[model samples]
Target: MTSFLEKWSARKSDKPKAGMRSAVDAFRVRVAEQKAYLAEFESDGAGFNKWRSTWFQRAPGGFGVTIGRDSIDAGQGLSYVVVETTAQVAEFLDDLAQHADNDVSFQKALEQNRLRRAALLNSAKAKVKAPAAKAATRKPATVKATETSQVSGEASVEKPKRGRKPKA
Candidate 1:
């Protein structure tokens, strides 16, 4: 007969609980469904933006995926899954379709997702580092004062007029 402690230890060695496994499986299924929808949209030559908007939500200037809590950090206390951008989804699909083995496909998807995220972060950083447009410089106009009429052969003092002359 097996002891209770031994049985508990055996269960603990399993790493992922049944609930966690189910959550991950559900996430995979959702990804597949999204991929199928995207394929249909592509075959019909429809605009991706419209389909994307319908499927995903915008998050911090990019798109996001909503997965179960177990799928993110191995059944952590986080309320929601980490957001995945549109590019990350595309890369994952590309990897999933290209690879034959499940493990290989998952590895490829992770690598591609990381690369896409790095590229996006770098682009954002570059935009932040870029200098702002310089404003155009204008030279001040020069005004010459001329004596219109001489008063008793003495130079008449004239004040420089500002702004446009009034219409007659």
Candidate 2:
């Protein structure tokens, strides 16, 4: 079979390390485990598209993430990573293992933040209600009268008595 890298992928500066091909299988192993975990949580797609996505950039044998067209509106974006050396790939595997733990921590943090926001909102609501509640609980104030309400038929009575004076 073709080597892990060939043609354009062959690094001009770093000759494909003597042992790279053999150790490259390790990349597959790490990728495999990631796929297995993804398999359990999968909700769509078939084959690798169903599980954790795997893409190869031949010139570099690098991998990275991109949002699949189908999931765009759902806001489910993709995360990509590539390992150029065996060390990087090893670190990637280790990171994958730690990712499980990280995922748990992330969830816990999200839940905590949600609870905190809820509590703050409740507190604000209580503060908003407090003044109105106190107003309701207190006795109503008596009205102080300054001006009297106008009666409907009240009219002026001082019409000039037209005593006709002597015609000028």
Candidate 3:
């Protein structure tokens, strides 16, 4: 007797149902549109540049969540999303969207991520500036006794006494 899997496969149509096919097509189109929208920012232009810089000023990695095509892989599933952000932030957002039970939790996670990123950036900036600060505050080296010498009326040098001198 044929296995249940084999019977099911035999009964299934090779082609998707008409409604399903249309839905898939629509999804594909939407994904394409989303990708196009994102690509617009990648180019150099005044409007896009301004938006990229300012859009997520309050968020980490310059990202905010919306319901849209997958930012990493546009042709796949849909969920809460982030765009124009670093890969790490995108992954964090994706995980947050998946596991968060409600809006409150999601907002909390987003805020935490933003604060964490700001701290990291501030730390990095501090590290970069620390060496410069140290250099600026450094004092000039003092002249050593050996470096001084008398060479006429213009300059004088005090030579250290050689050998042991009798105590007088």
Candidate 4:
């Protein structure tokens, strides 16, 4: 069976599929627009000074925001994505842009992002010798029977319990 790290590495090695880049870029543009909208009112004193457009708290006690045309409390049609506050917009956009409605695609996108930084370091030694070294260093799996006999150097036999014998 594959080890946990092996499985994770395999998943991380997958490149983001077509359109992934565009989707991420589009999401960024939308976020920028929302920020600009809030910025437009930043200098206004017409009862806008107390507004917390990017805060995540509920209204009255706090100011929540609706996305585009969405209601503050509910998600609307495809054009709008409602959120408790504007601060949550990026997270919602991440899921939306990655098409994370399904868990698998979401995981793939997530893995792709997780390893993005590692992809850039391209050191010469790692590129030339790492694979060969890794192959040479890997040890063969040990047999379960051999493992069981390691302490006593005996054949594979179940050892009796070591504590005081139970009453007959």
- The lDDT leader among the candidates is 4
RMSD of each: 18.2, 25.2, 21.5, 18.9
Off by over 4 Å in 4: 1-21, 45-58, 66-168
| lDDT (10s digit) by residue, model 3, range 80-168 | 44455644334543443344424454345444544676688999999999999997777644433334422332342355446787899
Per-candidate clashes come to 0, 2, 4, 0
Q: All candidates' TM-scores?
A: 0.26, 0.27, 0.29, 0.25
Lowest-sum lDDT 10-residue window in model 1: 67-76
Error of 4 at 66 (Å): 4.8
Candidate with better lDDT, 1 vs 3:
1
Model 3, C-alpha of 109: deviation from truth (Å): 0.7
lDDT of 1 by residue, 1-168 (tens): 889998787667545565443323444665677676656555664454555423444567565544321222212332233345555756644443343135554444444554676688999987776643221233223311223234422542455446797899
* Two-way TM-score contest, 2 vs 3, winner: 3
lDDT of 2 by residue, 12-125 (tens): 575576544322243335456555544432433243343334322213574332212111111122234555643454455455445423565433443454467668899999
Which is the leading candidate under TM-score?
3
What is candidate 4's lDDT per residue for 37-105, written digit by digit as tens? 455444463545434443222356334444332222112233443465444654554554345334454
Minimal lDDT window, size 10, model 4: 68-77
Q: Which has the higher lDDT value, candidate number 3 or candidate number 4?
A: 4
For model 1, the stretches where C-alpha displacement exceeds 4 angstroms are: 1-101, 132-158, 162-168
Residue 13 displacement (Å), model 2: 65
